[model samples]
Target: MTTSFPMNAGDGLYSYSKNSHLQKEIIDGAKEMMRDVIIRKLDIKTILSSSNTLHITELGCSVGPNTFSSMQHIVEALKDKYLYQDQVIDSTKSTIPEFQIFFNDQVTNDFNTLFRSLPVDRFYYASGVPGSFHGRLFPSRSIHFAHCSTAIHWLSKIPKELLDKNSPAWNKGLIDYAGASNVEIVNAYVAQFERDMEMFFNARAEEIVPGGMMVLVTPISGYIRLLRFFGSSLMDMVNEGKLDEFLVDSFNLPLYLPSPQDMTKVVEKNGLFSIERMELINIKSNLVDEVDAKTLMMSLRSAIEGVIINHFGSKIAEEACARTILKSKEISEWMKVNYEKASILFVALKRK
Candidate 1:
């Protein structure tokens, strides 16, 4: 079975590993949602009482110190709930149950570096489980809580519809399905997103026990629109003879940003989970006065550099396709004039 997906898993190279400081809002948001959902929605007492071991899994936990921070928040909350339910506090004796944390990502992930860098004071029994979250990675009814942050926007793979030469959706000169005037192309991308989401929810449903909760932190539709606009601008640059069109045709990111309503539909259709809460928030960059082109370049590169290398050989992506650097510079200049904002959605759900 081919489990390959466009992933960023080089030790400290991935944007996920580097954007901890820049993307602190989302990270903190995920932690807050986990606490709120567990206390207000999930049956924490039942989960603690039913099993001697509590299972918490982080899907798409890229090589990160932030993941550890998020996990710590979760493990601590679980412990607090268990202690409160017990109605006793023993300073010397342990009242809380032991935790088993599974960190999941792609097969090519830097698990070694991730594991080696784990904090010595970590509370849970940590384990690395390499697999895509779009498919089942754990046994049925095994997990109590599932957490994913800034990851699900990534589709499991590129939509085959885009690659079909004869199909109306055959995105030829354009690298992305975004900004395509053709309704068929837009439908193709939406269809792929729906399918990937269904797969993601279905697989998670089987893994999480009834009453378990999942908190998904993903990009909102507006963020995707901005990306599409950026991608379209890049294509326009190629068309204007400023950049090579072949480079644009050769690269496309396998990512999607769905509306909160779209996400709710997938959860409802799946029939295994019920929505607890969903909210979209706009995250504005602190550098409001100026566009940090160099910073943006680093951020974008860390996230998709691996994908660039994978799709177009490293030499082509770096050397031959030097215009990409120019494109990033162009994007940065555009960012200066336009107020760039990232809208993200936080969804909390409970398995039925």
Candidate 2:
């Protein structure tokens, strides 16, 4: 059963992209979980057919530093794997394996900063390809391995009710908890997600070699877990105003939090991949700590200053945001008094 919520939470109201430092920490955790897959199933040896050469691609890759770190780790891991087999590590970096890495995302992503963040000798090749990962980006079986972290859940773009004459099907059902049955809108979101994911796999089907491996780590949940956790009190609190206006801001931002089973079905229907490893991890988020939250909150220039303004007028939203922070004193008190934590990670993979 799909448990639905009132569409009152602010959506597309913030840019969650600037928190690269916090994102790096999450990536580190993901790397630990996925390292084995990269080595064994999606091993460069299988894709490259040579011990000394490999190709890597990071999709929806944001800044280059974290992307660079991940690639370096993969390269090192592979080098270590081959060391025992080859009896000696290559001295000449160029001779060991020419690691060609492509860090791709939207063309508008901060490529300049990403480039500056990279070290002198990081990638053999670095280029920006601007397009949705759901569509074609690279040639058939051109890249050895692909990895994407914390980025796939994004809808190509948020559905816009710009005209305001007749709202979208999804938005039609968006209502308060008192009137919480937006089946049309909810179904639309789910349908779009399914289609987009299918397209994503189809594109990957063409790009990933027959034996290539891919890992997709996103914020996900079992439908039961979602309805259980969110339905229990998350919605009630919002209805009661305990969470304020943007209460759903952090809780339900994912496009659709699919279960492990849900994802397995998605892969199965696609017919081009196989599930090798799957795990539900409690990932720390781009919001580092209490202090980090403040920075992240402030870093949301548009959320703080723009979206809120458009939604509820600038003056009122600003006042509300400020008051929300002041009222959150209880949240801080509760954190110290009680050990309250939230699980923020979901991981999955497909190997051909």
Candidate 3:
């Protein structure tokens, strides 16, 4: 498996910390649904019966601000559940549970930046756990509640078949399977998604207690329209003889946005979590004029600039990003008609 790349770190102009407003918007949009699900579906009594502390894990938590905001919301929601929503009839059972928040990501993620950006008055005791969420990161049955937002779409690695010249799945001169005319390339991506999701569910199943809850907020396949434009920009560079076609042929993004139906099948097949709620949320509704091409490119670049730099070196990657910016007006015009196609998938699952 290829090593996972971290987001652009630090507080620089191009860092993820500065350009993650899009992800923050998605997290904000899902806050109400997440709170409602926790109040109704989380078995607080079962969790409190075993321990006075609630262990919450945020998978794929990159360098701060958004991750901090999401965890704070969860902590407050759990407090509301414990103090108001729980059906514990005994008057003496009103004690609140202590919160332990685990921030998880790849080992290479900038934990120093994440730690420095943490909210000073936060209620939970925070700890950073570095590892892939596709495998176990904590002891078995240790987590009480798990949360992952706008991150589950990342596959553990790019499918190797896409790099093999002899394979039908070889994706030449393309950075991603999105908008690919070849079914083989798309199939290879889908296959990788299924395998990675299985590993993810299995690992979480082992870590979460039997009555624990997990909420996942991720983009649907339609979100790939933005990436398709990014790929087009690189291809445009290739045609202009400014970039080597071989670099484009060899590099592929290790990401997949699954449909709601696709996620349901994966959850059911695992048989460890029962679906509580699943729905498509219109991201456009959350941010109106903010979906313009320039803003989108900034967010996209912050998230994947490190990957590009690693694959094509700094000079070529910087040129590629600049070229994409030049096409902003055209992309903005396209967004006027097709923006609504993009949506976020929010899912609530209960451990069985």
Top candidate, metric TM-score: 3
Model 3 stretches with alpha carbons more than 4 Å out = 85-87, 285-291
Instruction: List the global CA lDDT of all models.
Output: 0.71, 0.54, 0.85
Residue pairs whose backbone atoms clash in candidate 1? 15-302
TM of each candidate vs. truth:
0.85, 0.68, 0.95
Query: Residue 194 of candidate 2: its Cα lDDT?
Result: 74
Worst 10-residue lDDT window for candidate 3 reads: 283-292
- Using lDDT as the measure, which candidate wins? 3
Kindly list the per-residue Cα lDDT of model 2 for residues 156-250, writing each as its tens digit: 53333311325444232122111225464455556656777898899988888777777777655321121222223333445666644343322
Worst 10 residues of 1 by lDDT: 287-296
- What are the per-residue Cα lDDT tens digits for candidate 1 across 240-295? 77667666665667777778878887888788888899987666655332245444
Given candidate 2, what's the lDDT at residue 151? 64
Clashes of 1: 1
